[model samples]
Target: MISAGIDIGSITSKVVILDDGRIYGSKIGFTGYNAERAGSSIYNSLIEELGIKHENVNSIVATGYGRNSVQFADKTYTEILCHAAGAFYNNSDIRTIIDIGGQDSKVISLSADGNVKDFCMNDKCAAGTGRFLEVIARALEIDLENFARLSLQSGKPASISTTCTVFAESEVISLIAKGESRENIIAGIHDSVASRLSSMVYRVGLNPPVMMTGGVAKNSGLVKAIENRLGTGVLVPESAQINGALGAALLAAKQNYRQ
Candidate 1:
């Protein structure tokens, strides 16, 4: 059976195709301002690229912030459940998940069987999220892609005490005015983000064998900061950015088999 999963996040959309329980193909694209269009466009593009006919897809599951916007989805699942399933699928030993997306951050504790035991989300603000980093990057006049490399070069990360994104940006600007090294400032930003996220992780009761699944998982500097803050190593899967889509596709296949 062929099944598809679409995850329409705030900043990007992803689609994953599964052929009889194995990954067939995946695609990612900017979500822009239209969630529904982004979801359909990415899914259709992936299907076409794989030379698969629409009718041949047995099931489709949608997930993420715009899960309900995918009209073609056979069903929708919450990001929490999808992230947990995706992490477990990647590494069964994973007992905790830290997903830092474009607009929000979440910490999920998984049961021994890969079920979500508890979760904590910071959806009310942009602080400690990818967007927050974007703001800081802009203030630093540095490309977001270079953040990790620069952060690693810092001898001593500057201190950023603000938890608010706006204030953080101002603080970064002030540091720049004070002739602070870009690398130090960037490292400090990573530490600030890690500090905020670690609080949520602690609140949800941290467990060992943690996995981080989200677009920000690609940020090696932030990952290192989080690892240092938690005093443990964190795993990042190759499909970290598309873990939610993979989970949705897996769910689609399972549901189709049951039916």
Candidate 2:
């Protein structure tokens, strides 16, 4: 059976197609101002690219921040559940998940069977989120792609004491005015994000074999900072950015089978 999953996030939309139990194709695109449009566009793009007609798909599941926006979905699941499923699909050994999205961050504790045991989310604030990093990157006049490389070069990461995104941006600006090294400031930003995320991880209960999902998983500097704070290695799957969509696709296949 062929199944599809769409994850409409604040920053981007992703679509994954599963042929039977294995990945067939995937697509990613900016969500822009309309989640609904983004969802339809990305899904259609993927199906078209794969030369698969929509009618041939057996099931569809939507997830992430704009799950409800996918009017074409056969069903919808919360990102927490989907992320757990995705992590487990990647590695069943993963007992903890840290997903840092554009507008929010969350930590999910998973059972041995890949079920979500408990989860904590930071949605009321942008601190420690992808958007927080974006703001700092803009203030630093540095490309987001270079953040990880430059941060790794820092011998002494500068101090950024605030957890508030606005306050933190101002603090970064102040540091820039003070002629602080870019690498130090960038590393400090990653450290601050790690500090906030580590607290959330601890709150949800830290379990070994942690896996990080979402677009921020690509940030090696942030991952290293989190590892240092947690004192444990973190795993990043190759499909980290599309994990939620992958989970949704897996669930979609299961749903089809149950029918």
Candidate 3:
């Protein structure tokens, strides 16, 4: 069966096509004006790229903060469930999952048999999320894709004490004017972001062999900082951001095939 998943996220939307239980194709795009437009665009991309006729797709499911906005999806699910489901689908041995998205972060604990046992999320703040980094990068007149590259070149990261996003942005600007190197500033941002995220994981107590998901997982510098804080390595998937959509697609396939 050709089942599909569409995840309309706050910052981006993703689509996945699954044939039976295996993913056939997937697409990702930044969210435009509205969630509906984002979902439609991603859906069209997968259909064209995979050369799959629209009606040939058996089922569709949506997930993420904007899941309910996907009018085309047959069902909607929370990003929390979708992330855990996707992680289990990819690697059943996964003990914990860390999903750092544009505006929030979550740490999920799973049983040995691939079920969610516990989870913790930092949703109200931008201090430790991808959106935080993006704002800092914008202030620095640097590209989001280049934040890590510049940060990794620093000799030492400057200290940022505030957890409030507004206060932190002001602190970054003050540091920049105080003869701090661009590299140092960027590194400091990463440290601050990682510090905020580590607090959540510490509070939740995830087991080892943790997998990193969501858009921020693509950031190598943040991943390294998180590892440093936790004293353990994190597994990052190549398709990190799309895992929620993949899970939604998998669930859709199961439902459709069973029916």
Candidate 4:
């Protein structure tokens, strides 16, 4: 059977195609302005990369923040369920999952048998997320890519007091004016992010091996900062960006079971 998974997140969209029992293709792209454009991009990827006809795809499960807006998805699943399933599929050893996305953050706990036991999500505030860091990066006159790279150079992270993104922008600008090195400011930002993230993990009583998913996981500096705060190395999946899509695809693959 052929199935597809489409995850339309706040920052990006993920598409996954499953043929038989294996992944046929998985693609990632920006969410753009709406889920329709994102879903069409996913479908285009399925056709161009996987050589699957529209009729071949039996089910398409939509997931993530914009799950409700996926017109083409036959069904929709919450990002919480999708993240847990995806993390389990990638590494069953993971007892805890931390996903830091563009606009929100979540920490999920899973049972040994692959069930979501508990989860805490921070969706209301952009304070401790990728968007917050992006704002800080822009204010510091550095691109996000450089922001990620420069953070690792810090011998010790400096302090960034403001928790709110709008205020943090002003703080970053003031730091720059005071002749603080951008690298230190970048390091400070990572430290701040890690502290906010660790707070969530602490709430769940972290269990290892911990897994970090979402676009923010792509930031090596952030990963290092989080690891330092947690006092352990974290596992990051090879296809970290598309875990939601992979989970959706896997869920679709299990549409039926034979007696």
Query: After TM-score superposition, what is the CA distance of residue 9 in candidate 1 from its true location, in Å?
Result: 0.5
Cα lDDT tens digits for candidate 4, 1-259: 8888888888888898888757788888888888778878766876777677776677878898888887877788888888888899999899999988878899999999989999998757898788898888778878888877898887767799988889988988988898888889999988888898899999988889899998888889889889999998999998788888888888877873211
- Give the candidates in order of TM-score, highest first: 2, 1, 3, 4
Q: Itemize residue pairs with steric clashes in candidate 1.
A: none
Cα-based lDDT at residue 147, candidate 2: 96
lDDT of 2 at 47: 95
Cα TM-score per model: 0.98, 0.98, 0.95, 0.95
- Tens digit per residue, CA lDDT, model 1, 36-93: 9999999998999999999889999999999999998999999898888888989999
- The C-alpha lDDT values of all candidates are 0.93, 0.94, 0.85, 0.84
Residue-level error in angstroms, candidate 1, position 258: 12
lDDT of 2 by residue, 1-259 (tens): 9999899999999999999979999999999999999999999989999999988899999999899989989999999988898899999999999999989899999999999999999969999999999999999999889999999999999999998999999999999999999999999999999999999999999999999999999999999999999999999999999999999999999977324
- So what's the TM-score on candidate 2? 0.98
Writing each residue's lDDT as its tens digit, candidate 3 over 48-154 gives 88998878888999998888888878888788888888999888888889898877889888888877888898967787877888888878899877877787888
Best by lDDT: 2
lDDT of 3 at 202: 75
Which of candidates 1 and 2 is the stronger one according to lDDT? 2
Candidate 3: global Cα-lDDT? 0.85
CA-only RMSD, every prediction: 1.2, 1.2, 1.5, 2.1
Ranking of models by lDDT: 2, 1, 3, 4
For model 3, the stretches where C-alpha displacement exceeds 4 angstroms are 257-259
